[model samples]
Target: MKAADDSYVRVAVLVMLSLSLLAGICATLIHWLGPVHRPMDLIVPPVGSAIFGGLIVALWRRPWWLQGIVRLALVTAVLALVAPAWFYTLQAVSTPGVQLIVVLPPVSSLFVVLLVMVMIFIPGRLAFVLALLCWLLIALPVLAYLLLHPREAWTPRGIDLLMAYGPVSLIVVVLLPVQRGMAGTIRRLASERARMEVMLHRDPLTGIHNRRLGERVLRGVFDGARSAGVIMLDVDRFKAINDTHGHPIGDRVLQAVAERCKALLRADECISRWGGEEFLVIVPDIDAAGLHLVAERLQMAIARLPVAPVRQVTASFGATMIDGADSFDSVLQRVDRALYAAKEQGGNRVVLMPVRPAAAGALASG
Candidate 1:
């Protein structure tokens, strides 16, 4: 099913643009084998999309440029399909009674594009059932026209639109149900797999990436970037909060801080819950000094949020960037040590680890 009516209109435009080019060319080749080329054929080719294209333009109110292109392409397709019949209509041999032959028109090509539209844009049983109804609707008209006017419908230089084209459309629509069912099953499976993957990575209590997954993600980021900030964060006096507010309230506080940190993590950030009351984060572009800025930002985000029934909550953060070509593992170890130092000094304060003598001096000042 279409997500909305606007989406249906866009899909219709794309379908017309894609299938018309291919089907129009095919129709041109097939009808050339017929006889009796005519002025009408040169003028109109084989008007398939014209009817439906016009319908979309009127119903959807598609953009003027798209409508213009649709009108032009549909006209071109009709002209291409009918081009072969230009001469024969004028050269009809007179009969004692009138030498007559049987033929169908060139409505087959239109049916082909319409079938593709149903397959691509529409979903489920509706696509198949509606397509079947349309097939019969278009098929009968071509069939009747071919039956009534055999000489015109099927000539050596002409089209046998109904008799030749009708059955092909009916068969296509009949096949749609199976194809639609298969596609639905595949999409559902893929969506479910993705949902499960997300569940596996998450900590159920805190809704944060679990330690293993978070570590994996941060390691990848640190390895990929030339410079990055590794920050360790812990909820301030989390034990005291748990003791005073109860474990349920403590869980809520942890959940709130996790959400704040997650929001702070941009496209190049990876953050996860390292353990109870602790979180780990990696920011790809930050240097040692820039790491301090990032640490401060996380501190603010944690402190700013309004968690219901918990008036005052804050997080202490410690950050360090790799000093001169250190391995990702060493960088993490250094940063995590710095985090412990911050907790020892005072709760709710940001601490920075010195990667070099200059950084050490800056940390003392901080």
Candidate 2:
């Protein structure tokens, strides 16, 4: 489950447990204050209190058992509230001089609280179904009893209770499904946003960060005032491979080359498909020696494999340490020049841009 869903469960469990404690306390006060001796009423409060308290403790200690705990709490809360309302409605009807309208209306109001609780704690489809069942179990029985007793219908109180209990319950039942639909829409939108982010940043063919994301990372390295390096590599005679084999096999060659480079690089280093048949590698906290070593390793890894149908593959590399004063275009221009120099030297070799540390430092401070 997601962290948000886990948090929702925790909060729901806490709310139910707190309400159970409140109910238990109120029942205890009523039992002491009232003149009537109701043994069942007295028994319910402590039992409910124990169940809720134990559940709270169990959840606090072992939150991994949340699914089971939520299911248990939902069922327990429904039974605890529904049973009392049913028994209270029956008791109010049997006794003399008890106004059925006044008694049943208050008992029926409890369903409203139950409906809201289920909507908040449970997920959409299940919550609506549970709320509907509770309404049927509690509201239907009370409405039936009032309808059967003819004397109860003669009074204005009976009509008031009937309206509040019957039609009101039906209204909430209709609205809950609409709420569920809205929640489902929100979840789908969140999923779409995540998918769009991946598409924007990642290469579809190689499944690595693309040029746009690589440039953004490069800008961060420049801003941090740290020593870093960029290695620009182009597959030597790449067009020849595409000409010899089809584009499909050429694509496989690119994928194979990308996998080889990725396996050799450290966690902190990044390789991006710079453009057609060209790749750019970014390495942070590196000196000139380390940068050249990485470029050589990449060259060896790609040349080692057949890459199917193609007997051998080689890459020409151009590397330079990032200067503090360089902008994005300036850096690319310098690396491209070095790459041209390597290709001019007959390909499959590493060329490093000449460095002037003193001049670079002066420019950086200015």
Candidate closest to the true structure, highest TM-score:
2
Compute each candidate's TM-score over C-alphas. 0.69, 0.72
Query: Of the candidates shown, which would achieve the greatest lDDT relative to the real structure?
Result: 2
Candidate 1 residue-wise lDDT, 96-175, digit = tens = 33322332245556556666556555566766665665555544444444466566566642253543445666666666
Clashes of 2: 0
* Candidate 2 local lDDT, residue 99: 50
> RMSD, each candidate, Å?
6.6, 5.6
- Residue 233 of candidate 1: its Cα lDDT? 89
lDDT of 2 by residue, 1-366 (tens): 379877886877777777866776676677657676566567666777777788888888988887787778767767766676677667776786765455432334556666766776677578778877887776776678788876786577677667766777677667766776787798889889888987999888877779998898888887797789998889988999999998998888888888888888898898899998889999999998888787878877777857888888888888888887788887888788778777888888888774553354211100
